[model samples]
Target chain A: MSEKIVQTSKEKQEETSQQISRQWKLSTSLGIMFLVIFMAITVLNTFAPDFMTFKVIGNFTVTYLYSVLLLYIASWSIVLYYVIKVTTLEGASI
Target chain B: MIEIPTAIGMVVLMVIITMGIAIFARRFGSSAAEFYVANRGITAFQNAISLGGSYMSAASFLGVAGLVWLYGYDGIWYASGFFGGYVVLLLWIAAPLRRFARYTVADFAFGRWHSKSLRMACIVFTLISMMFYVVPQMVGAGDLLGVLLGWDYTFAVVVSGILMTLYVVVGGMRGTTYNQIFLCIVLWSAMFITTILALMHYGWSYNALLGDIGARIEPGIWLDPLNSFALALGLVLGTAGLPHILIQYYTNPSGKAARWATVGVLFIIGTFYMMTPIVGFAGRAILGDAAGKNTVLPLLGQALGGEPLMGIIVGGAFAAIVSTTAALLIACTGAIAHDLYVGLINPEASDRKQVWIAKVSTIAIGLFTIGLGLAFKGYNVAFLVGLAFAITASTFFPMLFMGIWWKDMTDKGALAGLILGGASAILIITTNIMGMHTLQNPSIISVPLAFLAIYFVSKWAGKMPDDIDDIMHQMHSLHSDIK
Candidate 1:
């Protein structure tokens, strides 16, 4: 009876760790996806320099509005999302 | 506006305070853990501030502002890449490395593979990347004293070198951490004062600073999609690969706190970086192209608020050099004493012996850094920093990414990638320095090649470690799971 209980507990632990990794995978993917969009904008800025300098609003160019402003906000947001999501992951008690 | 005597006095006071903190923190440095990661009891907030302090070297504080002042929109990209890197660390590298919770990057590889050669490889690469890193700080520190105190360059280098070595050898990581925390706040506040004064002068119009569009960019910077992309990639990934910066994460209390601290660093540093470009733009607006190379921040501070303000800014700049050089010296000490000596040469060594060797190694490595700095004094400081990042991005980032996330990675594969990746990156930089005009950065080519080297070599080489599942669980899951 004791042996059976030990086996059951070991199986349960494995399942829980697997669940933790899966959740990390989901959150990490979201962070990477956000990065892709940011990098895509950087690519456009380099390839389309003239367009990047286009007056988006009040003499501010695309590069300034996006690279200067949006980059900071996006990086901060995604990382915040990551931490919040990870800390709440089941079995990631940490 | 540039008051030499006041500046010298302020810097001298700052150094005295830094020495005091190091000496006081020595009580906490009796053991290896206390010396290395502050016994892993550092609060997330403290870790965050030191991370910002240790990271905002002369490279970020002075280099970025100078780049933006000279290159305009093109230069802002470096700061963006620098901040963008924290996201990568937060997403992938920070938690796992903290979970491993070892002394150095070399320890991670050795623990994973149980291979002495692999551990030695990491130590070599760590030292090499660090050597590349120290040159820039030495160069910057010498130049800073030269400008602020009118001291000769070599004399300034020697004085700064001895002062940095004294504190770290006595106090260890605990001392360095305290100094970094104090110094980063001082430096950031100095930048803050300069920014507010600049904006106030312009009636708080950010766009007013941007009015001179035609003269924004000099010839051929942040252009050429290939070059820009390469430079940006090196800048972004480089932060994650940096040994000193990543080591700070281990100071956090847990994996979760490490994640939080990583994000905190982005915000702390993010605000400082944002101000850098503004100060740069203000310099361009006020002084045009005559603002002097790598001296934009001090010059702008003097112009806006005159001598007292410039004195504070320059004093903060001195702190920047000292804090970063101390941080790097501690890292070099780790490469020698922790990673090489204890981990390799004398695995059974006592804790008391370990601490003693660490102090000796600190002096040796500190002197070596100063010697290299004196030798490489003529190179541009910013370019040297970029070279350090590129080599790190090429070698370590690929290895850590695969090791942390992929369980199938073999020791043989990692070793192959470590050597090939490091060699190719250095080859390009060295050749470029000899005037081949090799791409200004090597990350564009080297990162992919390094990843491929590890991938193909893993498929073709040594068997995976027997405890791969246990390692993965330890790195990815909660501590309870390992039980």
Candidate 2:
């Protein structure tokens, strides 16, 4: 296979400076979104001990489903959202 | 003399197969790419498996279940930090890092700053993290063998150390990559088999299992909110800074490929983590109070499916240790041989000479870590891994984060952050070991301090790389190409 370093065209360069800020905004904003939810769950699990232990379904309590199961679901949803959005916004994926 | 034949048989086969692959890879892996990064042609799926395999270690495979059995919800919350880390990587670090780095994290640091001292500082931080990282796996491997296979701990550690050193020297990264992929399959399959059997034993009801566990163990018994908070901080940030984990992503053919692979990594590890708690709860409900902290998986295997099941989990444990220890060795070799010997001492060195240095360095590192393992017998495996992550979070996480995004990041700023972050973290860990015991994980204090150090020092230092804009374009733009 042949190989060469990437050289951005002048038009692409202008486009990319805009893209970088947009991508950074998207990546970081989504990243912060995930971190905040995780930390909040941690605090709830830590301090609100009685609230976390209330059984809502069968033996599955708020701590088990909301803190762990839902947190995992949210984490995956964020990861997939990032992938799909990046591909849609750009012709190529970053 | 007593032995668990099923476990011994399967584990022996695993060792033989990996040993065979290492020898086979050594014969043909002559080029820089072949030895260093699997010829830089690993597919997304393969890289994903390797990434999961490298990260799983004994801590994830065995310790997660053990913790959940012992501490209930508190355990999974602490362990989830490992998964929490990749979110940071997927967002901020993965792509730009792959595009910017050539061989190791030092390459990325030096590429940004063009300072030999900064590169050496990168190596120092990498070495400290890798040393802390490698010992736990080594000690875990020895302990697992001694408990299950009945081997002497010293003999078990020495043999595994010799095997790993020889495998790394022969196979390099290419061999490590393939071994990691296969080992990942073995370990994940073991988790699947054990968890499925436990569910089946409990009438296949998730509710039934949780009902039993909640009735038996009070949720309040597992609460340590402060320690959990600190641990979560360390794992979430420290994972992004791991030296062994960082280099594997750079092995991808392109920056985009690395990002794509991470999606799979999250899914794979996420699935594995979800299953671990089941095994933990199952062990508690079924075994009553018979489960030991790290022995939950193997014991659950015995209770769930007898000796064959136990064998698979035991073999899976060995695979987890071997894959992680080998990755650490290769990372150590890259630091000493590729970064130091080739980058500084012999810039004009031949390909064969570079490979030779890497082999010698692997031997030296293997001996040093094995000695540490034998000396610190019976140390908690998960605690050491968490400490390693905390230090990495304190140091490398800051350097990589700012170096990629912040344009004015100067060499002096980078070095200052590295020293301050790494030294402070080590001080905390040392004092904690010496009974200071003030904080379980210091990342809560150290991570923000390191980030602040980089920012203020860079602002005051007043010199930035001339090609900062071009480098940024290479990392962020679609037109940025890879060779």
Candidate 3:
């Protein structure tokens, strides 16, 4: 009975490892993507100031309101939604 | 100037409500587990509110607004980093940590490597980081009280410290958690109403205000990319390393609840942070440079709607300071009691003894912080908070992330990383404080050095625990059946 229990535990551990790996892959990729987007926006706003400084909306420049909104959407809303979706899906199916 | 009576009334009311909840929570806390983590019974929503309240701090409530009021677009980057940190927490650290760790981050480090010395190092760093973090909140409390109620700085600090200590001593994590939830609501509502009133002064259009602020920006001030990147990086990485913030995960019922709490934190804090920029912009456009920069929001409240609104805003800011200070105090107390006294000196200590030690530690830390807060009365609250973040980012972030993800991490590497990272951060910040302007954001250099220290030292030392694979497996496994 103990041998069978150990065998089942090993199987569960392996299954958990696979699930965690998949989750890590998704989350890390999304995190890196967001970091890159953040860095890109910072660089664009820094070096090519004119491009981002131009009036994109009514008195709002590309750097002022637009970049912030873009970051919120891409980094926060999109990334978080996917992270929750992926993690919760695994939880549900399990 | 604030209307003394009204502001005093509102602040007193907030304190009464907060302490009432805390005293009520005391009934649920008796053992060390109950004291430290509320027996891990907090729901996702309550945990979220508590996390939001603890995370926001006076640094976010007043410092961000003050910075934005002072620095234009550059200041908003601070808010961005603050908000972005939760994303990192949500994806990387939150769930896995909740699943693996029982009490504190030190528990995980010790559990992984079975090193008493490593746990001691964690205690040292956690105390240093938390004490450093607490001073600013205490200072903000003193400043706000001095302004609002005509109290002396020392009196204000003592009052705030004693009140926070009472909450933690009486109620422990349960009390602190509920108090934090009430504080977050008060803080968010205050900021939201103030922002709306401020926007109304500009005819209710965010675009109009943003456009005007954008148009009025001085050439080089609004677009410094390097500093912006450094500030943003520090806020993001530093948050992941915060001892108080990370311990909030343990308050939730499960790893899944912790993750959901992070989601709730994201929306709750995101809304509060969004309001900061409006306050900053409005303060700049309407009040301009006339008001004391740090007191811009409070002054704006007075200017817009008189004593009643200003009292509400001041009350909210005070709650932000107290809630954050309470959280930091508890974190520090845990390090002393659980990590040091119980963990190292007296491993056989009973839970009742541990709880007593924690309560005593809370009082000691509170008194120590009050002294530090009064001494550093004139320092910028935001900048001081930034320095604390840099220290955490350098010391804790590298060790934690590597420990969680990499199987090759050794006790030797973690120790070297913590010592070197902490030393470098302190040296750089001290020099910067003492007039060396080149290394303002020490994390840009210190964090990388810490990571390299861990990486290179781990490779060279090549002496990991035999059960490292098993430890890693445990950390990765979603279920907690191994124990």
Candidate 4:
């Protein structure tokens, strides 16, 4: 009898030659953002030390409130976008 | 005004209700599937509430306010980090994890390699990581009872452990889910009422509270951009990799359910985190360091509207600790039952027997955690939590990232990473616990060393598994055109 093939669920591990520079570019952007924020903290700490803690600037502190607000909104948006993208792609193909 | 005994009764009532739900939940989940994962049938709405209950542990409830009370504005970092971390989880592991692992975190790792060794290695890592992690929750439980009801610390530990174990042993996942959902509601309501009263007492204006905070404590520390950034990094990245959070993916009935539940989780967690700072800042303005920093919310209640509101907020604090501890107990027990005995020791164990094993293991782990809490009494709980995160991120993060994306990862490579990363983190933590100056002085050096060890060892092996290309395709599903 001919040799039988044993099929498994996992795909073989091979380097994709598609050469996606986009992933690297995105990573670099993230790194830069981290650096910028880090430097911003240093500068604020040095110059506007009093402003670094939570104080109401009318309704919010420019630093603490802004950072929290941005992080909060960005997190939710990313989750929603990722979920929708995956679900749509899965449905369209499968 | 409410008396102390009345507060104690409400708290006890909440605990009994939690136990009742857990015992009742077991009836529906007669099989292993039902027991471990609520049969993967929990709706996003219910799951989201349970997630809220789990997420807002003693750390969120007490830790944030206390940090704020002491450090002032610097404390918001905890809320930001804890909430934002889920975003990272959504990106890094969420949908794919649900799609890949039909069982445990180890099941996914082992499935990829067809290696029992890899599965066993993961089980050991999970246990080590979770034990240190759960100890802090137990400590928080003890502290909450000792302070609130004037109960002895040991009594609190035993009380919390016995109730949590009863629910988990009898109810399983179904029981845990319902208990968490109920507790989440009670916790949120207590927080809302307390915040409003505190604000009303100190003038119901955010601006007024901020002005008071500004006048009393110098905003010099809060305005620093770089420190804020570092805090953000810890909060976001740390939250993403927490094992309890990662396990939430398994609670979904389908991949679609995970996506929807994430949406619900986002709203719930975002609101909760945002509100924490309010209570923290409000406490600073109204209570004026009455009882202590950590007791900001409790003090604010009593200072603003006398003992009755204090009783309610105190009840909420109990809700927070119970919900979090109960969830951790279930998750850790599930990891043991699913990853250890069934996966490694007995692969063909029946569902009935598996449920029995889970129940027994739940109690065993609970008792051990109680002993740990009593031993580490009054230790810096927040810092201990950070140490747990450092260990988790170091060990599981590398193993998981490589296990999913890199097919060339070998058993030898995995074993090396597991031993190196897990051992290093454990060693550092043990040293810190023993008061070692060099190890505890700076986590930065040790944390990176753990990751570097994983990478270098995996590379030093020098040869990829022959089936590398096939694994890549499975992970990316490149063959399946996403139309």
Candidate 3 at residue B2, lDDT? 56
The global C-alpha lDDT for each of the candidates, from Candidate 1 onward, is 0.80, 0.82, 0.80, 0.66
Better of 1 and 4 by lDDT: 1
Chain B alone, TM-score, model 1:
0.96
lDDT by residue (B399-442, candidate 2, tens digit) is 99888877779998998888888888877877887897868788
Every candidate's DockQ is 0.34, 0.48, 0.36, 0.28
Q: Quick one: RMSD of model 1?
A: 3.6
Per-residue lDDT, model 1, residue B313, is 77
DockQ result, candidate 1: 0.34
Per residue, candidate 4 scores C-alpha lDDT tens digits across B103-222 of 566666665666777777777766765666778887877877777778788988888778777777778777888888888888777777777776676567867777777643334444
Strongest candidate by lDDT? 2
Model with the higher DockQ, candidate 1 or 3: 3
**Candidate 2 residue spans exceeding 4 A from truth:** A1-16, A92-94, B26-28, B215-223, B380-383
Candidate 2: residue B210 Cα off by (Å)? 1.6
Each predicted model: what fraction of the native A–B Cα contacts (within 8 Å) does it retain?
0.43, 0.48, 0.34, 0.33
- On the 0 to 100 scale, the lDDT of residue B83 in model 4 is 69
Candidate 1 chain B, run of 10 with poorest lDDT: B474-483
Candidate 1 local lDDT, B361-385, one digit each (tens)? 9989888887987998878766677
